[model samples]
Target: MASDMESDIALHLKADYFDFFDLSIEKIIGSGSTGDVVLAVHNTYPDINRAVKRFSLKEEDLQKRNISLERVKKLFYHEVEMVRDLDHPNIVRRSNGIVCPGYLAIAMDYCPLGTLVDHLKKMTSERIDKFFPGVVAGVEYLHSLRIVHGDIKLQNIFINADNEAVLGDFGVSFKMPENVQGVKSVGSTMGYFAPEVLKKKPSVDPFKCDSYAVGVVLRCLVKRRRPGYTSDYMEEIRSTKMEDKFRYFLERLLCRDPCKRSTMSEVQRSLIEFTPDRYTLELSRKRCLEDISNSSMPQQKKPTHKRSASSSS
Candidate 1:
């Protein structure tokens, strides 16, 4: 599989890079220090709407950045390469990629509904039941291939045109080498990092780290906000009145010891057998309706500042 993927990437690299002139940029949907995300459509494929992510100046002045753009190129290439091989419905689909002089861009299906976080803010138990299966299936597939998704936050989980949860963003993902306990170090986001990772311990299990993040993601989905990376979050979880099925599952996922944490397969199995409690579903639905009502209200106008007459004179 590895050799086959290498050959495939080679072929893809040789293929014509997407022509920037042919793509019409609609608007800037998101931007950050790493890069900017634009909504664009290819003139040749007008019917297709894509979210194009541009990694600017990633290929310039390698020594200053410490890591060469060659390495950066591999990261994007690896993501594209992995996407090409995996055909699961829950994994975000990649359309095309271009490596121009100063930047690299990859196009993917434009998710109009937004991310999992957006949906979770007004979450319902039905939504969790509906989306959780697909997400677990996607993660299970990655684990089956020994690919550790180093980042597993809600932002990386997108809602597709079908309203299904599709996991995206493989910037921190890596294939685990056989016989290795874990990687020495890796990048992560706050609140999502496992205890071992937070402590900067040697030989941290990347896969287990993913489970820890997923546990946090699930908590956020229930609370409509990311949990603080402190004992307070755990205290809240303990005190919160939740269904036994869910509480039990979360207990396994949120265990402080990575060894005690449930594997992706175990999570998948639990989700299969477990049904969401009715009381929880009702509470979720109530919150969703409240969110709708709040959003429907008109925003009040801000008072305008008046210029002083002295300044005019």
Candidate 2:
């Protein structure tokens, strides 16, 4: 049966997600995230597009650890199962999973605007108010599904052409069962991990860990400044008795005690009410666009027209 399944997948090598949905694949608008092998594949049949994530546990680090191939396969399968059960607009929609000989991959919705990290790098303080609510909404939606998005960072949040934010990259996500203990080093990035995780505390809640990461992301976006280790700026976050609205929100998210931090729902509510003035929004957008335009991506060439008189020969 496994052999037959492999043969079936082989037949659909270049098939797009829409093909399974009874649609076509032809209008892919953009592509990014080469590290994870993410691509924007469009469905020409239905005039739609989606993101495709190809999973391959071929990392040198894992291979060096001498982990069993079967164990890696099990981890991939677990991610697929978790993604299949999730349903939320803020979260990228998982369309389907396909297994080919020695590989596995999943299809999901695409966002053309770009990554939140990229967007934040270009923007000023003024534009954050308009752009951040969508991010908060996405996080809130994920929590509603009872799934802890173990890696909630700027890179994983995508922005659509319409400026809507969608959460992506569930490579480290899992559902929380009641009375469950924490997972160790599941999918955390250095410097962004919660204090409890760094200390390896017992009974650490995955949901709280996610909140802490979210706080870091929010700070990075709002401040437009990257706080390095040993920087006095971190003191503002570490010492949290202040009453500034943004500061308060950050304090709650980065709270030492998980029980004292704000819930995803509460974070979403606060974001909605914390609107910035219009001038700030416009200025930030302008600055962000300029920065993006100056980045390494090549500038598109202008089109030119030519006469066809030479064809008479």
Candidate 3:
């Protein structure tokens, strides 16, 4: 809610965040490269649930990473402070933070439905379309504050009890430098890398990079598959059977030329004017079932030649 993103916040002070809450060891909800998240309950508010993430780093881990304990602490609090200060409906809320001897812990709103990755099997055109706006709103809010999410992916997007998409994981986030057009560093997520990033260009626009990642995340959810590393996914989008508006929207986001890429503002504006066509997986499945039921052709006979074979060779 604060327009000034750089304003100092008092949330990340070292304290016993868990002293007032109870963690359910049995309910370990999430595990990732940095740490594991478990379900937590406030001591006074027994009915409410939260996700407590405990970041882990041992002596060798620190040595291998070439980072000091103080540096790790600063980075951990950096993420916590960003999430704690942000007040947006589509962004996950952080409540508390604590630093221990070797690791740190933070508590946040618990989205019972889990993340987008958990619902890959249930994702459809409608579901993907429904959450598209929330992602945009969250990113829009971040950009409004001059902050970049740095990482946006299915695993980082959570679905709450209300089934609304909310963004999480600000560990890799950074504030866009004042008056600066672009930054030299970015998050290390490969599939979500923008054209400028993939090309290993020195200076990359953080805002455009985030927009590119949003497109990839949307594509993976709608397709119910992992984001691919191919550079020509736009061609695949064109060849696929989807609404014209929807197809064009994706093409613009995935455009190889940064100058021609669609910004989040443009995307939000387009959505306001038109609602794209919804997808129907049942129709596709039914057609496939009908073809199989009507034909006796063996699967192996469909293709006769080896893809790698060359007569001249």
lDDT of 3 by residue, 126-172 (tens): 78778888998899899888899998888889998889999988888
**Regions more than 4 Å wrong, model 3:** 1-16, 42-46, 57-68, 100-102, 276-313
Tens-digit per-residue lDDT, 1-313, candidate 1? 2255555553333323345456788788776444677888778888777887776654454554556555766766776665666668888876455555566677778888788878977887778777777777888889888888888888888888898998888777888877776888654688888877777787888888888778887788777786685522556679988766667777877888889998889998787557556557877998999689668856853233123324545
Query: Which scores better on TM-score, 1 or 2?
Result: 1
lDDT of 2 by residue, 1-313 (tens): 4455334332334443334455444444333222144554444434455666554445663466555666655555666666676676666765566654444566667777877766766775555655566667777777777788888877787786667767877767888766665666444676567777777775577777787777777777766655344212346665544336668678788787778877888888776555655557877998898678558445753232113324433
Clashing residue pairs in all predictions, respectively, total: 0, 5, 0
- Candidate rank order under lDDT: 3, 1, 2
Model 1: how far residue 244 lies from native, Å: 2.7
What's the distance in Å from true for residue 205, model 3?
A: 0.8
Task: Show the colliding residue pairs in model 3.
Answer: none
Arranged by TM-score, best first: 3, 1, 2
Clashing pairs in 2: 24-44, 24-45, 26-44, 122-288, 126-280
Which 10-residue window of candidate 1 scores lowest in summed lDDT? 301-310
